[model samples]
Target: SGSFVVAVDTDVMGRGSEELGKTLMKGFLFAVSQLPSLPKTVLFYNGGAHLTCQGSASLEDINALADKGVDIRTCGTCLNFYGLTDKLEVGSVTNMYEIVETLAQAGKVVKP
Candidate 1:
């Protein structure tokens, strides 16, 4: 087991135009990527899963995190429900069982 921080990106941040929201999300991910000790994993569910899929504005940053050894996982059920399974571009697909276990074993679980 290892330390972990969970990022639950629910609405792309802020409350305004979708364009602004997307920009904010990109900035957030970029900041996260600059962290010295990055999170062990990033779990995306619900709308957050969109950040790990095709056409995401923050895909480059997310891909950087993945290259740095972060476990980027998007909810499998969510992708299917949202019809984005084939559109995924980063990370791996994960189920609730693993999600629950990962969160439970994490040293710090952060929802953002």
Candidate 2:
């Protein structure tokens, strides 16, 4: 299959209720983990940075994805802005240029 990537720009999955969104995000990650064909990479930025760091409910699933060879990356600038520079639990830091390249080079991009 052609390479695909997931781009998360928020800590939650949708707008409105924060709790519901978080719950959905947790489930979303878990569902992704169950897929036979995994994403080539998962990029976290903006509020999405919170999901790959400490205190996130989705950490276990995200880590599982990482363990399975998914390239997990969180924006370095976003980590600093959120004061989570050292709390990254699942992935390494990445830059804007890399983010752009990843998205651009991907055959398909999924946002959820």
Candidate 3:
């Protein structure tokens, strides 16, 4: 299958109240995990780093995706920038180069 990827650049899914956006993000990730064909990879960067770290509300859904072989990656610099380097719970650290290459190679890219 072609490389289908999802890039999440923020902790929230959209504009509006922070609470509502976070709720939407949780629901969105859960829905993604339930997809018949999961994305080949999920890239977490910027505020998205929060979603893959410990204490995150979406850890369960993200972990479920990981269990099914989705390549979960969180930006190393972003984590450090956010003081979350030691809090990561579900993915390997990646850099901008890898992120760029992955996105460039992806057949489709979904952002939420």
Candidate 4:
């Protein structure tokens, strides 16, 4: 099987009101989690770091992916920059090298 990756670089799915964007994002992750073919990994970076942190509405969905063996990784630099270092809720901290390598090795990459 060709394993894919999900890279989320922002908390919102698109440009617009933050509130609505977040709702869309939550729906997106939920849908992803229910996919018949699960992804190999889900990478969170930049503003997307918020999705893996405490108080994030997407935690349940993200955690569901994790329970199914999805590798959830958050950019260490981004988490620190966002002051969410201690708030990471569902993944391990990752570096640029690992991020690049994971993407490079993936059969396909999905970003949303």
Candidate 5:
């Protein structure tokens, strides 16, 4: 199939205060969702795992991606470490094995 995979490395969009960082992250995801062709997968890891769970400002956009047939996967270990395992909403909980495999097999791996 013709698809791209995007990996999110951190919860915040860029470097700065937590509040500003979160705002940027939300804007980024929302913008991505508006693209005519969405990514096939969106992998969330590290601090980025927080963006797929409950209470995330970007939850609506992320859920829209899921509805559009994107595979939204969040790292299980990261979620547990962050004490957010129970908060996951829009995606599957994935382990490191799957994460590495998904990235390795993606047509394109965009980190943002």
Candidate 6:
């Protein structure tokens, strides 16, 4: 099968009340963790970086995905911009070059 990659650019899925969005994101990640075949990598940036930070409700699901060998990478610039560099809990930091390269190399790129 072709390699699959995911790029997350938001803290939530839709433009709705903040509470509902976070709830949906949590459920989405939980469902991703339960997938029999997971993506090759998951890239988090912008507001999505918050999902991988400490105290995030989605941490457990993200951690489980990481533990399953999915490459989890978050934008360093994004983390720094949000003052969350020290709070990253589940992934390594990546730069724009690698991010672009990763997306370029993937057979499919999924954004959610």
* Superior candidate under lDDT, 3 versus 4: 3
Please count the clashing residue pairs in each candidate, in the order shown: 0, 0, 0, 0, 0, 0
lDDT of 4 by residue, 1-112 (tens): 2399999999999888989999999999999999999999999999999999999999999999999888999999999999999999997999999999999999999987
**What are the models' TM-scores?**
0.89, 0.96, 0.97, 0.96, 0.92, 0.95
Query: Cα deviation in Å at residue 58, candidate 2?
Result: 0.7
Clashing pairs in 3: none
lDDT of 5 by residue, 52-102 (tens): 988888899999999988899999999999999999998899999999999
Q: How many Å off is the CA of 41 in candidate 3?
A: 0.5
Q: Cα lDDT for residue 23, model 4? A: 96
Pairs with backbone N, CA or C atoms under 3 Å apart (clashes), candidate 4: none
**lDDT-sorted candidate list, best first:** 3, 4, 2, 6, 5, 1
Ranked by lDDT, the better of candidates 1 and 4 is 4
Q: Per-residue error at 82 for model 3, in Å?
A: 0.8
Ordering by TM-score? 3, 2, 4, 6, 5, 1
Candidate of highest lDDT: 3
Residue-level lDDT of model 1, residues 1-112, one tens digit each, is: 2386766656477787887877777888888889888899999999998889888888999999999999999999999989999999999999999999888888998775
Q: On TM-score, who's better, 3 or 4?
A: 3
Q: Tell me which of candidates 1 and 6 scores higher on lDDT.
A: 6
Alpha-carbon lDDT of model 3: 0.95
Residue 47 accuracy (lDDT) in model 4: 95
RMSD (Å) of each candidate, 1 decimal: 1.9, 1.1, 1.0, 1.1, 1.4, 1.3
Query: Ten consecutive residues with minimal summed lDDT in candidate 2?
Result: 1-10
Compute the lDDT for candidate 6.
Answer: 0.91
Rate residue 66 of model 6 by lDDT: 92
What are the Cα lDDT values of the candidates?
A: 0.85, 0.93, 0.95, 0.94, 0.88, 0.91
Q: Which candidate achieves the best TM-score against the true structure?
A: 3
lDDT of 4 at 103: 96
